[model samples]
Target: MSWEKSVRRVTPYVPGEQPKDKNIIKLNTNECPYPPAPKVRELISGLRYEDMRLYPDPEASSLIKALSGYYNVPEDQIFVGVGSDDVLSMAYLTFFNSDNPILFPDITYSFYDVWAELYKVPYKKIPLRDDFTIDFTEYYGDKQPNGGIIIANPNAPVGIYEPVSKIEDVVAHNPDSVCIIDEAYIDFGGESALPLIKKYDNVLIVQTFSKSRAMAGMRIGYAFGSKKLIKYMQDAKFSFNSYTMNRPSLELGIAAIEDDVYFKETCNKIIATRERVKKELSALGFTFPDSKANFIFAKHDKLTGEELFLALKNAGIYVRHWNADRIYDYLRITIGTDEEMDKLISFLQKYL
Candidate 1:
């Protein structure tokens, strides 16, 4: 009982279900249906087993170099972690130390609240508008002198994207606090807030390889910020774990970012599929927000989200569904390949 009292207790974030069967149609988690860049595959196959014995670079210089070359940012202004989740968690620990509650959307990424609670940091959930768009005025910090701001550009689950100009308005208003724009799905269609990083020292723009680069398995995510802001994150990361990134991830990440053409082609394919699926879903009497990410958040007119979710699951299809209030009737479906999308469309036609 004494040890139990001292143990940390908080509800952890539940990720989308990962089914083992290869036969199932998985559109639940927003993973790229295609394989990683060809160069990444070559690097993986060619990596030597003997190199595993040695510790990886604490600085992750090689991956940072590749990112710098790709994004045209200086090495001192970039920070890499195992994934965006790791990067965000470290940032929450590093920057959100003030007593005022941090601000985020009520229906944004579920991880934001989880991290806030885990760190015992105060936070306030500013509700999104009726149509699921962020009201930038609420985040101005004029009425509420808050600690920090972490916004998922094109906020997740809802799949609606806000413009970078609006994001800049928030950043400019909250000059005293750090402003983090979690751009995990930005590669799909949304404009990035990266340019703001150059103009505002408080802005930190985070992106990941999981969605567009098709390397979710490799777990490479990075952030761009001013030199001083990046140094704070790096210091916090090294203090926590000097070797957060391993050798294979570092080498493979370099290969992923190098092939620019393949990455763009892959994103284009997904965007095309998503648009087509949107029309088909509309014809079947489903309404959803205008999604800019690789997924659609949809609700059917005739059936509850649970009913459709269970039906699809029984038929070996998987899409994300949540029982939370406001979004309880919606489904978040990731865009798969043309063939895979066809299978999903066919299933809906017969089921409806």
Candidate 2:
């Protein structure tokens, strides 16, 4: 069967590989090395199999209320999805139109580009500065109007964060268009854009349990914005899949959100680990952006990113490698448990 021309043109986003070996020190995906709060496990264990007969709360009300209280936003202003990726896709459908072109940093979460392609929306990629930082002046400060804007706060692959104040300045100025801040990795470091949502009706902040919350397996994510904007996203979600979040995920998400202490403690640990990794890499003559996220983007003059990635893989260590322009030599390595990181460093020391 033939697909629609738009579907045919789309190239789906490639997630990090989940290798079969359990012994491998997996650092390719930016997943939390620690287990989610023990409450999540308890919650999951308590779930009855018979509950599967009924659909999950179509709106995930409990989780929404929990998030509302957590973010200090009203329930009407929050919407949860299978993952932040779902919320992002819904944003593309609900806010972006074919008439107005979408704009985002060229070196950002790859899924943003995929969404643009999937929706057949016109988009222009504003290149990052030579120093690998987002140049908001070139994007929003210019007179040109865009259909919508999406940016990863601490952008992926590069692992550099844009200040929340700078983001506020840009969103404050762009009142006419939808501005989406994908904060999937923000909890690790960097300020959340949730505060700006109260001030800007056009701004939408998407977050996920996959990263900081250690709920990637639960496939839960959410978006915070004005009630009106959130309603539109809800409409989009219902139009596509009313019961987008499953029962187990919904319950686990609630438990995860409620367990703030575990989340904060784990995040702090990851932050410390990230700094240690950064210092070690820098000492080895490797250059990397000062990462605020749980990962580091490091590259050495003596070896290519691909070479290091392959070498690490051969040594039972996994990390992410992208061949994009100006970043081809860098490897994105996730901060894992202290023991896991030590193993990775040992492998690098031996191989490099």
Candidate 3:
């Protein structure tokens, strides 16, 4: 009991439900319905089991080189982690140490607040406009005076993509703090704020192989920042754990990056599916923000979000729904294969 009193405690983030049944259509967690690049399959079978006995490259140099060549950023500016969550947690720990509160959208990624609370970082959640879009002017640190900022472009659940110009404005205004842009879904259809990294020394742009590369299982996430910013993050990470990236992840992540053609094709397919499904959902009396990501956040004109979520679940379909304020009426449905989306539409048609 004495030790328990000193233990750090905070409510953890609740992820989308991962049901056990394999036969059901799964569109809950915003994962790519498609398989990873064909090369990834080839690489997995060829990997030496003996390699696992040795520790992976602590710097993850090979993977970093691959990413550097692909993204055209210098290797020194790059940092890799187990996942974007890991990368973000490290950034929060390394940068948001100020007594003043960090800032993020109230309706943005749920993990931001959890990380803030877990690390004892004071934070302010600025409310998104009624249309579920961020008011960039509100993010002007000159007015709000915060220690740091993190934003999820093509914001999750809502799936609205703010323009790079708007993102740039936030970064420009907040020169005193580290501004992080979480672009996990940027490959889907959104323009990235990555260019701003060159313009602002204080900016860190984070991305993941999980969503677009179909390697969420591999848990590869990386960031690009000024060399100084990245080095500081590396010092913090190495101090915490040098071997955050394992052998399989490093090798497979490079394989995923090298298959440029396959990667683009997969993203295009998801985008096409998303646009078609948008039209279909609209016809079905559902309305949602224009989604640039691989998911649609929808609410039916006649039915509640939970009603549809339960009905679909009972029919062996899974889509995400939240009981929280403002978005309680919405369902965040990951864009699956065309057949899966058709099945979803067919079920909704019959049920309605």
Q: What residue runs in model 2 are displaced by over 4 Å at the alpha carbon? A: 1-7
Better of 1 and 2 by TM-score: 1
Q: Score candidate 3 by TM-score against the native.
A: 0.99
lDDT by residue for model 3 over 1-352, one digit each (tens)? 7999998999999998888999999999999999999999999999999888999999999999999999999999999999999999999999999999999999989999999999999999999999999998988988989989999989987999989999999999999999999999999988988888788999999999999999999999999999999999999999999999989999999899989999999999999999999999999899999999999999987889899999999999999999999999899999999999999999999999
Per-model TM-score, in order, reads 0.99, 0.97, 0.99
**How many residue pairs clash in each candidate at the backbone level?**
0, 0, 0
> Each candidate: RMSD to true structure?
0.7, 1.5, 0.7
> Which 10 successive residues of model 3 have the least lDDT summed?
189-198
lDDT per residue (tens digit) for residues 19-88 in model 2: 9989998999999999999899888879999989999899899999999898888899998998998889
Question: What alpha-carbon RMSD in Å does predicted model 1 have with respect to the real structure?
Answer: 0.7
lDDT of 3 at 178: 96
Worst 10 residues of 1 by lDDT: 135-144
